[model samples]
Target: MNRFAALEAFVRVAETQSFSEAARRLRSSKSAISRNVSALESELGARLLNRTTRSLNLTEAGRAYFERVSRILADLDDADRALGQLQASPRGRLQVSAPMSFGFLHLAPAMPEFLARFPEVDVDLSLNDRFVDVVDEGFDVALRIGALPDSSLMARRIAPIRRTLCASPDYFRRRGTPQTPEDLKAHECLRNSNVARTQEWRFVDENGKPSLVAVSGRVSANNGDALRIFALSGFGVASLPTFIVGADLRSGALVSALDRFVPQDLAMNAVYPHSRHLSPKVRAFVDFLVARFGKRYWDPDDGRP
Candidate 1:
């Protein structure tokens, strides 16, 4: 028999002073309650109650045990209640993992508003270019771009991430603008080494067909920001995410090339371990991300030219 169950049964019977009343409160039969109390007495080698023809009363040992265990049970109940409150309210540290560029450019900026809305939640945001095992690393949520592979994790699409092929006006003026995808071969292209095929750029042709071109340049870097900087200084054309280049393109510091050949947009996703029983902090942060970026914030207008 479970010692805790037996103790609970004895406490209930002693408090009620009636086996039948205790059974009713516990939603069990009187015989079961009597047996539990009997088991508790056998386990402890002590009789806990005196049963008379018309009444029941706790013995000296029973009264003392009841006083101590009842307080312990009450404290356990209070602990459970406190944990339930923490689960119900967003009032704890929320550990998040995200890509370095996206985290710094987008998530870092929006954090003030998120904290203002959920003043109770504290955020521990970790940014890195490398992928992390969220469960192993103890992260509550992670942000990813593009489609996720088959996994036990759940994902929600937050926004669209569009990539743009761009270069500074001076570079385009010096190198001459390429009218067709094949023309890119003659021009230098700054590459981001993180891509699977750094030399290859994919696009959709004017006929809505897939097209690819092998590109090479003097500079190649693992960071997108670095590539963007090189492209800005008139070094070479670079393919970069709209979030990184959108402002520069709008400000005319960078001009987009081959707009007609823009590829399909990738998705920004908030990924978590489980779909069910999501914590209040994670749910609130995800909802904030969706609401905060209901529309593509970077490309407020359809990117053209």
Candidate 2:
């Protein structure tokens, strides 16, 4: 009495003009096929078939229903094939969410190569500093930095996010450099207001001893790029990820402070709602990111801040 099965049976019998032939094509008993078609006609309250021992023919209503149902069945088959192909290969639109700074500085620059390698994957990237609900927002994947909170989302670490407390050389000259985590209190610190504890900076010493320092700043921003710009202009010392300030540190535009103590390192993770039966596009993109940013690509070669 399944309606779709009945519809399918009716269409098959009408097309072949024989219940026996339709049953053979469908691998079902002829009686079952006849019963299904009869159920369909009874439900519709219409005589769909005119039958005799010599020949079988469709009524006018049967012709109209068959036309529409056959098209629907064909479309359903096409959709099934398309979904199967999509699962088999990394093809179709991939919706990705990422942070503004990392997306702009790294992810966007790497898109050309990713697209070249995965030509069938069309990427739609959204960059924002705010945390997005992957399931609710319909994102296929999202790039998250720092420690992740407890969640139902599945995550894979893509890279290590090492941070450094640094300022321009000119600023160090004017305000003096901080030699210890405590000295940060006396300096003009630039904070990222996006985090919950904006003023609290955590560090670990060479022996792995942790220290929490409460810092104040004249300026605070939600975006890392804006904070990096402020630090580059000698406005204040900013605690920033090496990814954003790595080149600047290497070029001596910014100088590190409290070298003996390392800022609590974070990890860049790619998060998705489900792990089991993950789509090829999400797997490919996450694997690409992991391979691209091996170990400490954003950090200096010598591993100095």
Which window of ten consecutive residues has the lowest lDDT sum in model 1? 296-305
Cα lDDT computed for each candidate against the true fold: 0.84, 0.86
RMSD of each: 16.0, 14.4
Candidate 2 local Cα displacement, residue 134, angstroms: 0.4
Residue-wise C-alpha lDDT for candidate 2, range 181-215, written one tens digit per residue: 88889999899999999999888878888878999
Clashing pairs in 2: none
Worst 10 residues of 2 by lDDT: 78-87
Considering only N, C-alpha and C atoms within 3 Å, which residue pairs clash in candidate 1? Answer: none
lDDT of each residue in 211-255, candidate 1, tens digit only: 789887899999988999999899999988988888998899999
List TM-scores for all candidates, in order.
Answer: 0.71, 0.71
- TM-score between model 1 and native: 0.71
